[model samples]
Target chain A: MSAVEKASRPRVAIVNFGMGNLFSVRQACLRAGLEPSITSKKAELLEADGVILPGVGAFGRAMETLREQGLVSVLKDLAAAGRPFMGICLGLQLLFDESIEFGRHEGMAIFAGQVVRLEPGIGPAGRPLKIPEIGWKPLRPPSGRGWDGSLLEGLPEGAHMYFVHSFHALAAKSESVLAITPFGDMNYCAAVQQGRLFACQFHPERSGPVGLKVYENFRKMILSGR
Target chain B: MAAVRFIARLDVKGPNLVKGVHLEGLRVLGKPEDFARHYYENGIDELIFMDVVASLYGRNSLLDIIRKTSSEIFIPLSVGGGLRSIEDIRAVLAAGADKVCLNTAAIANPELVREASRCFGSSTIVVSIEAIRQPDGSYEAYTDNGRQKTGVEAVGWARRAAELGAGEIMITSVDREGTGQGYDLALTKSVASAVDIPVIACGGAGRKEHVGDAVTQGWANAVGVASLLHYNVLDVVGGTGSYEEEGNIEYLKGRRGFSHVERSSLGEIKEYLRGLGLECR
Candidate 1:
């Protein structure tokens, strides 16, 4: 990028946890008109204006990679300082207290919740809602007076976002829940907005135009009042 | 509040978009990115990219295209065609694919479905069944562009595939492919009702209503289209229609129930269905 472009762009570090595809996250950042860098370096992360934890695959492996890369303590520090951290999919699950996937795995504990398997049941139509509920589902925006969309500020009320997860988070406090998505007859927490930390259980980078708006909102949220 | 998905399926050869009759008589359309951009701008719910020649040529050919498209197009991208091993799946996913569709490999090694699902999570693996109708009215799954036949029945195998941890089933009717007569409602309904997971019905979609038929009558969670969606886009020089053509934009808008100019639009399928009360992206 040219000096002018680089100088003007907002640098967002896509944390290299080594589990998911960080390319798409960088792409989304670029689409949202921001400068993105995928790195595990503490200095680079600390220097950047923001951090995004893009994840896929298993949660235990992701946390292990984070620990191996020495990203756990750095991320904990960044998150503790409210450094505008965001997570996606398994990254979202990793923000919780713990999980019981292949085995019991402890998480970053930024959010009070436990990741658990989606209960077996039928959807509204009576057809069985299969596990790993793949494809797009609408987001049920938060209703409380102060629990607004926040990072999800610009998305439509019921905007459909792509999701691919078998385990869902059950937040300890309801106010932390930013949005919910239908998994069968019941709904699961789709996103959480705790302090400066914002994360979703879907691939916003892969959810088309509205999904782009999410990154745009995140950039705006991070850049404002800074 | 998740609505039904209307997807655009593009079969690629090298860097170019290509489509065949009955999945044969392959004809080059244009750059995969052009059509992908057009579809995305027109509000396509998702995209499926199949490297039609990966088995004949090499899987490497699609990596560049997928990398470029995944970087530009911000939507769910499902890549298929010659994916076999876990390494191949890893390479494709690394190249920016959200899900990898498996056909021949999954059939050749049923354990692959279990292993991939177990490793990457079931949501990332899509098992495609190209079904051919038998004289006895039962449907059988075929692989390798329908050149090879798997004796397993479509409905029963879909259930087995799901049980083996296949998260989603993309059932394409080989008999109806490229025909555009309409989706094989019976075949689609059978496989869709059989598996609890989301089903992507491909093949035989000529009219906009065919998409509707797939959801209402066939119970498919989503409809995948190629012929009816891409046939008219590329002009004589194998390029996407000249940008001067405002018809597709108008048609796309009109389908969203907007009042405006009238003309031939590529996404009429979604437009028509959107008017019929099916929530479309």
Candidate 2:
């Protein structure tokens, strides 16, 4: 595509799971100057220049909906095809192997991991500090990543992002971790990037300007086909 | 300065972070760690995680998210959703949450507020009231994500929440939610007037000026919005649409809402206050 055509906006799809933050995701995409479409249709998802899977509810329900929609295989196929696929919150967790929230439920299994609770024994003792950790915390990106990727570009390392969730990914391999945040005695991975798939455990849309940069960077990658 | 208190809200279901209106707008933002770090870096004063689906799920996942976030953020965190008894409150607090918010559970068992305050102190207890404007022009309290009407008056609930030892009352208007129309000033003022403790006005914010309005006109301590800020609709981009445009971008900018203007004014006031060798507070 020529520069003029390259400047043409890409059609982005923000996957709707019937239980996620579609507005915020859609709004963020629009602010990034990308025309965003919300859909659960597999064909629409596969047709997009890039796909964003955003969720904010239960793990099992999200999985069930994805399975019902038959999106599980398409998303995995898209990722395997090196198409840029991003997952936010539950969307990210759903990329894991499974979750132990209420019971064992299979995930997309795109990444090698399981979603597990942040056990109380690992943190400060007053009470078992509430589950679903909310608010902002600092993010430490992986060393020497050079901040040039589709995500975390134009954003400084150690920048904080908004988060609200009860469980986190227990990655089967440590290399999948793109960033880490210190919580109590444990340091948990914040962003995980494996191949063309990018997943974050925080709400970039809600993280203000610094967070907006992440979305913009993602848009740039989608446009550049990088 | 009172540190301009900030409260972070985490709406969750099962193990995922969910956002929506009356359980819509469903999309996950990010992982618990990403959100926690972002808010901490942005200088949030306090954080709140409400499991919008907790009651239906019969479990509070805010505790798990809180424990993970608190370990990373090192800021005050509050957890809510499906919180029914003192044990639930205790479990959340122990998980690293500094406060616990009560909605349906507190309404069902008003004594839970008192019990929570006794064990965790009033400062750590918050009462969240979801209100929707009725066709009669009065606001009715709703429970279960506005699914059930309680016929409880908004003002009455504010007073009751305070009396029941709630340190703060968070009032969210369903009608104005995600609309960016500006907060319901009249309703906010009534609730603020009814309670001595801090009152947070949530919903219908599209700009920084809305924050000031919520604080000044609504007499609220804070304002909450998920759409405008989350979407970057704010005029962070300083530009008037080009000469090709019919009018100046400045006019188009302010048309979104007045809260942005109010916030800018507040910033100026704070700066002026500093220059005058006086505290903004």
Candidate 3:
């Protein structure tokens, strides 16, 4: 295949640490018109045009799996390379330096932030809205460049996406923050994009068609050498 | 004022979408990805994709459908049908399903519910009950896609499911299914009263009033319906005609204008919930 053809059919690797929604990531990549491969293999990470880190469940367990698989160094190297890389949910949280869920656990430190619990003060319907805010919630993009310029292209601002998490990201640096969603008494960053790395607190795959467009945007970026 | 909640269900057979009466019969619709996108754009609180043939296939093909659907639509998607073991639950959750609904499996092996809850957390497990009314005026639980009678009472099964760590109980009335006669309020209230967790009333729902009835009279936290929103299926002509002769053409055109309600951001949903006096913990 020609270089352009090969590049168009980029192989997107979904890093599997046995704690993430990997199959969804793989399926999203395929729908976005790319070849998706799931691997804990370090070699696959190096060979792939783009990488995705997806997670669900606990931070401590995820860290344990990542460390056990020796993917910590591999992920760092890939991010340092500036290839198109994205993280979802705990995957996005892991891109940060650490999380305070169930105790302090160190993350990949790809981004400068800390994951903290959803503020306990705000209650919905006279009852605690509960942890892991389940179901669909809307996202508001930042002004100026907006979502279209980065990983969120083709998805409309204020579009509702699926979310299922108890903790939210508090970016250390405001410049790295790309989007914010208001929950309870706090407004926190929902998406962060620093250079080629992008992370979403919501599951784009679960977000419906608006989410699929996100994958398509990622595919376009990887193909166009962005 | 009470906040309205809507849930969209996508029935799947292999990689394709399908719908049927009860659970034995089915007709293919289209690719799940397409339907999921349509529903997300149209304003749905949550989506459910049931692998109608998962039990027979001995595996959840809904995983692949979820993977495909999730990539396109950013919405909470629940997968059901053919969940027999913890391994099956793990595979489905790992495949991008937000929650796994257990019906036949939960009835057969109640421990599986506890095991799944312990491993994946109770919030990720949902227990689905297919209930049919017997001659004695008691609703008996049926399993194996509603093909076999369990002789277990619906209310009792619902209680057991919750006790075993099922985060939510989905009660479906098989007799009232696809009939659009409104949900079986008694069935819903009985199950809801029997469980501490949220109860979702499924089966028949034909109008907006029915939605309110499910939430109020039925005492259900949520309601699940399929036929009323099938974009590809025709409406019952005066409630008559074979489903096949009705044809797979888009009906209800120009009769009702679609909602112009903008998609609320996560923050907005929180605000709305707050406005409703809900505590967002």
Instruction: List all candidate RMSDs to the true structure.
Output: 5.6, 15.4, 7.1
Q: Tens-digit lDDT track for model 2 on A9-80? A: 678888877764355566667667777899989889988999999876678878898888898899989988
Q: Sorted by lDDT, highest first, which candidate order results?
A: 1, 3, 2
Write the residue-wise lDDT of candidate 1 on A81-200 in tens digits.
Answer: 988888888889998999998899999998998999986575544445656666788887656623344888766677888887778899998888999876655678999987888999
True contacts kept of each: 0.65, 0.00, 0.34
Ranked by DockQ, the better of candidates 2 and 3 is 3
lDDT of 1 by residue, B1-281 (tens): 34677778988876667776667766666678888877877777789999887742354378877887788788888899999899999998888887889998998999999999887778888999999999999999998788788898988989889999888899999888887678999998898788767888998887777888888788788889876767555442235443332112333223232111122354565577678776665
The 10 consecutive residues of candidate 1 chain A with the worst lDDT sum are A140-149
Query: DockQ of candidates 1 onward, in order?
Result: 0.55, 0.02, 0.22
DockQ category of candidate 2: incorrect
| Candidate 2 stretches greater than 4 Å from native | A1-7, A121-128, A143-146, B1-281
**Model 1 interface DockQ:** 0.55
Stretches of candidate 1 above 4 Å error? Answer: A1-7, A146-149, B55-60, B235-268, B271-277
Q: How much lDDT does candidate 1 score?
A: 0.80
lDDT of 3 by residue, B144-180 (tens): 6677998899899888888887778888898877666
lDDT of 2 at A218: 77
When summed lDDT is taken over every stretch of 10 residues in candidate 2 chain B, the lowest stretch is: B238-247
Model 1 interface CAPRI class:
medium
